[model samples]
Target: METSVLLIEPDPTAAQEITEILQEGGFLPVTRQSFEAVHDSVTDEMPPKAILIGTDNVKESVLSFISELKADPSTQWIPLFILSRTNEDSFRIDCFNAGADEFFLKPIHPKELLARLRGWVNRIGNFEESAFRDPLTKAYNRRYFDLHILLELQKAQKNDYPISVAFIDADKFKSINDNYGHHVGDLVLQGLSKILREKTRTSDLVARYGGEEFVILFPKASGDQAANRIQTILEYVRENPVAEYEGQLRHITFSCGVAEWKPGLSVTEWVKLADDGVYEAKGQGRNRVILSNLQTSEHDHLEEKKKVLIVAGKGMSKSIVCEIDSLAYEIQEWQQGIEEVPPEICIYVIPPTKGFDAGEYEQFRMKHLPKECKTLLLTENHKALDSFQIMATGIDGYLRGPYLPGDIELGLRRLTNLN
Candidate 1:
């Protein structure tokens, strides 16, 4: 693919010169007249890899535009460069302060400019790739999947496109690890990652979510389509050996669940739906693929399950219940102030709200919760900086809001080891 560079040059002659220079240097230059036109021209589907602003002087307007570009999440990742006639220290400082990744003085040699541009672009690309990839398997890490899924969800919602998620787990992986050793376990993971990368389309993203578990993001694919593809991979895995154990070729199998995006599903909920399919596949005997059968509005609703006590403001409690309902976990809301709840409670969800007191909640948890039970606090997003104070209260985990029920589900699942 040709690398794209967005060039914002007001002077027509300078713009033409820069365009030619970028093209000759092996970049596809996207020229625009003003900063205001950037938003209209650039899109999420095809954002510029880098940006270059060529100007006569570093004006306050340019600084503001730079700040805006850096603030917007979509464009913030692109490397931004400022080219000016003045090499004044103050102008250079101002550009850096406004989030310019690089500053170049005019009359710069074309080779030098291209070198700097290419170097910065490659540096950013390598840094981002390293941050998003799992070191062991070379697959996308959980953090990448978390951010990417949200973006895909937003795009699917806006463009009325289909997006699907496949939650994959190595069938009986624990036995493999116990019997073979961590070395063979690592080999199996690497082999699975290789197979997924080769079998899936370029548009698909393969991510190692956690211990023996992986997820694939299928953009523009429906649940059925994603499942069929996973089925093919499953058959391939069953037929091929992934690793050698004691001079014996050992094969692996995957249990997969596929869930397509719907009109109103949060990131967690969408992933949870796919996860439920994995659970179903495991239940029906592993080494198969299952598509989520539940609707966006319906949760598994298994009332015979253990209980989760939700203690928050009335509105927040109701919202939590609505989100948790899909996971089929029994919910008991105690918005009137968590004075008391049933003895069968396995999880406690308390959000800091109007009547919330961290100290009080801590005391309640200490007095009531068994070793097998865990407490998760819900704090506002801004309160993340004050996490030390929140954690000092001795909660098992804390979730930052604005969050969906699926977020709660994911958190609780992580803490499920407490039992």
Candidate 2:
């Protein structure tokens, strides 16, 4: 694609010279003689890749134009250059502070100007490519998805256009790793990702949302449309298995959660609802699509009410505390050096003392205890047990060392009755 430049200079002679220089140097320069004209041109015409403002005699107006462009999010990312005849240090600082991407002097050499403009254009192109394109699947990444989805959602909310989000995850992904090794697992993901890319619409955004999970942002799509599209992709994968790995056929399946964009909800909230639907699909079966109903009670109410407190110990007890607190509970960490216990569910890390002091322990408990609170004590050495026993008057649970994810999950499940 040919690079385009917007040259904002009121001086007719300077504008003519710059336009000639840019045209000779392979840039399509669009010149504007006035500040208001430059603003109108940017809004009406196709946006240029870069903008150059002559700040020699009209520094204030040039600065104002740059500021206006920077303030508008749509034009802010375009590279901006400032040309000035003033002191290099002061002018450069002023330009940079006002968000200019580059600065040049008034007596511009054609070659140098072309080189800098080309460099800026190349750099901006590379940046945009990197920002939008996924490294693995060569599809759009989450950053692009987020930005595009936000814009689509706004249009949908304002003008009644349709938008939907689909949360996708590879089924039995861990089993893939365990069976064929990680290399083959990666190959499976890449293969599935390629198939997904081929299946999706050109206008739709398909992005990897970490690990085996992917998300698709569909503009002008209804919930039924999104579901049908996703189901077709899933069916295609099941029918055509990847057979290139070790002469073994690998059947890849996916689960999807779909949700439509609604007004008055942030993008994060909309996505979380979609994620909940994905979990529902996984719970029902491996390969299925679940559409989320905003009014449904399937969403966990406990998650809204649960609060967790995490405490750290010098030894294995820190892990133990974290594990015990993970059971069916929402938790936050207690800041170190805070004398007061902030929450009702408190997890205290018991340090091993040489001699257990019952009076001191009782005083400590009395100081930190809140009425009707559940306390979990974590200990590393058995010697700390004596102190815990002394301090165990109000304690609800005690955990020892060497905990695993399963153990923590199981313990929390039992503790919170969330089996």
Candidate 3:
């Protein structure tokens, strides 16, 4: 592989000469005319193996760049050099103190430059990769993620490939630490790391952003794709508990939010969007993936009300959206399955006229009723013989056929104690 170098030199004449020399020495040089463009160019797929700066004077911008570069643990070890016209004693000392690996007074000398560059490149290549990883979880640390995500966003825009970031926050993590000592919490985190690694693609990145908060970078994936992937992880964790101790099974669940990349958004804004998703998921409940784009439009729904999700057949789930009083609850309709992401009350509409058999409606309700969510049954025909059975199926309330909007609110009030 050709080692890449970030060459920063505003002078085109000097930049071209250095670029050609570096190229001849088997190095791939990515030249940026300004410090601002440097970040736009670097990414996980194209990190510079070394940084080369050419300057006639030590300006504030140059000093700031070097200081910031050294401060970031990700870029700190990559070799840096200052190529200048003056070899003044004070200037040389300042450059060395500012973290430049070497200071050179250059007219031009390709042979000697190549020798030094080669040694720095080799030294960087041999640096322990473990320094970029979180020791306990064995996942890439936040520093690795912070830099790679910025690059991935730039790559996505340039290559016209979709990229997504998912924020995963372990639900009730503090409770786990409190109930089961820190040792078991550590065990659970380790187990979660194993699952995340196993679930993501080899090309994707899995990083422990911080304690109980993880982030995943999905290259060439949309927000929907990221949400689906996280949903799979949610289901797997649900089925398999992370730890078993003292005759009790301990499990950890996470809320995930996925944000797709859009051009012109900064890295901080991109992460904020994904973090908003995680916040929404956790707010709804826990153990679910919520895509920012999937939210109901403000023009169509009300805000700051209890959320009601209706999961039923095609036409059956229709009226609930229109009939729901926005003052009582905010409504979202799902055609196939119940939303595990919190629902204050679920209304399962069963139309007997649609040819669902006598007992089939009860079975359907039993299957789709979310574990913790209160459920209300609105059926057009089950009022006949299934009335007694309906009450016993764990449904909170049942509305007979042809119910009015007033009746809907009444049932909701009864179940949720709004009255």
**lDDT values, one for every candidate:** 0.75, 0.69, 0.74
Choose 1 or 2, whichever is better by TM-score.
1
Q: What is the C-alpha RMSD of each candidate to the true structure, in Å?
A: 9.5, 14.6, 24.0
Top-scoring candidate (TM-score):
1
Write candidate 2's Cα lDDT for 339-409 as tens digits: 54345565566553333345664675566656666666655456666544645575666666322233333
Q: Which residue pairs come into collision in candidate 3? A: none
Better of 2 and 3 by TM-score: 2
Worst 10 residues of 3 by lDDT: 294-303
The window of 10 residues in a row where model 1 has the poorest summed lDDT is 346-355
Instruction: For candidate 2, list the clashing residue pairs, or say none.
Output: 308-330, 308-331, 308-332, 327-412
lDDT of 1: 0.75
Clashes of each: 1, 4, 0
lDDT of 1 at 54: 82
- C-alpha RMSD in Å of predicted model 1 compared with the true structure: 9.5
* lDDT per residue (tens digit) for residues 383-412 in model 1: 343566656765677676545314666676
For every model shown, what is its TM-score relative to the native structure?
0.67, 0.55, 0.45
